[model samples]
Target: MTTVPTSAPQRATAPPSEGGHRRRRSRRTRERPNWVAGLTSVVWLAIVIVPIYWIVITSFKTQSNYYAENPFAPPGEPTIANYRLVIESDFPQYFLNSVIATIGAVIPAVLVSFMAAYAIVRGRRSRLLRWTNSLFLMGLAIPLQATVIPIYLIIIQLGLYDTLLALILPSIAFAIPLSVLVLSNFIRDVPKELFDSMRIDGATERGMLWRLAFPLTRPAVVTVTVYNALQIWNGFLLPLILTQSPDKRTLPLALWSFQGQYSINVPAVLASVVLTTLPILILYVVGRRQLLSGLTVGFGK
Candidate 1:
């Protein structure tokens, strides 16, 4: 009875060889350098940030110091003199002109494009819709340069040259095609069931668009609006060709005033450049989140 006690055999463990293999594999992965990808990213950032740094630094320097001193060096005495001069000059008028033109151009462009896009998406099977969409797409290919001469002549005939309306009208006309394209693509993705449900509830086309589709398509709308704002806000060529008076000038033209016929005031010119770019920078910063979200929502779905 005392000799009956016994134990089962234990399972054998793997040798240290398997453990060493796993450790070596992990160590190899850890040792692999991602230097090339990291270096490329750093270089790209430097390329973008350097110019912005130079502009901001140059804006603080005196006119003589800008050219005489090393461009890379910081100013000895950073001054607001240039900004004061710019503000006291006709810059405010030019800023107002720019605001007027940009707003006027963007609002109508967005509204008209939204309607066109909705129609294109809803009426995709119709021949007339196909023709209309093709025409809108063609508008994108036509260069503004080709139309400038005719546009200028027409502006003169309408006696709208040197006025904000002239700038707004032309910009709206050109911006619509791209806006339509962006919005139409987003509209096409909206669930047809939503539209059917609205129809069953006795909703009209306008009601469905306003109550349902418009709300759903907000991201695409935001992206298009921001895009148009950037275009209209920074436009130089159209304003240059259309308007002449200093008072009628937009920011780009106003900035040109700092460059004289004989010698360019480099510092002042750079200052103006900084001033002109600030609005756009601010706009991007403020709307960037919404813009990014919109783009993601529109494309990711």
Candidate 2:
């Protein structure tokens, strides 16, 4: 009984090895459920879901029923006629045009942006590159609406007026600046030691760029690509001004068909909208992981 008493003294005070146990107790005391944060998240979620809910539910409604019935109510009689009407119109042609223009613009813009970003980060000593980067930064300040007339005149001068090429060219020009800015910052976050290691291994700059930098920065690449595609796909002004003929119209322009001289086909228009959003929704889902990762790339260790 006397010999067993020695363990009692040690149990009264926690051993140094039990610091983790103390920390766990302290953490439990500190942590609490944040009611304010939970409330704000629920509010924001409702704000976003309501509009999408209205659009999807209304798309299944008939034009007359959309106005006569409660705006927020589920369709009294859900019908696919609105969808059928949108499809009967030249929906496929407009969708194809949007695809053509978005693809045409994004591919070249991303390629150029990536290479320039790599160069800007790696060639910081070059004065010319510095100036070029500044020029790209300036492009961001120039709004698309501000240059509408100038772009129109230039497109006419280049004889690309009323063509998908007209839309593609301007979209590329507008996209490059922002894309370069995002990508260059991501490139800078790359470790200098990796670059030096690759150099010491007798790799050329091109090899290092493709093999090392490209793979490492894939999330950024996907982020910029998806963003640029969304912008170009939803572009209204460019398609509106650049193309005159109905044949050259894009998916955004397809909405114009639902607007008559006297009245609007609200349900049919919403149906067209639903169809138009599918591609973008698919794209977002596919790249969502990359997008979130890219956005938070250099936030902290």
lDDT of 1 by residue, 92-171 (tens): 89999999999999999999999999999986489899999999999999999899999999999999988889999999
Against the true structure, what is every candidate's RMSD?
Answer: 4.2, 3.9
TM-score of each: 0.85, 0.88
Candidate 2: tens digits of C-alpha lDDT, residues 175-255:
999999999988898899999999999999999899999999999999999999999999999999999998899998777
| Best-fitting candidate, scored by lDDT | 2
The TM-score that candidate 1 achieves is 0.85
Return the lDDT, model 2, position 1.
Answer: 38
Model 2 clash number: 0
Model 2: what TM-score?
0.88
Candidate 1 residue-wise lDDT at 57: 93
As for candidate 2, its clashing pairs are: none
lDDT value, candidate 1, whole model: 0.88
- 217, model 2: CA deviation in Å? 0.5
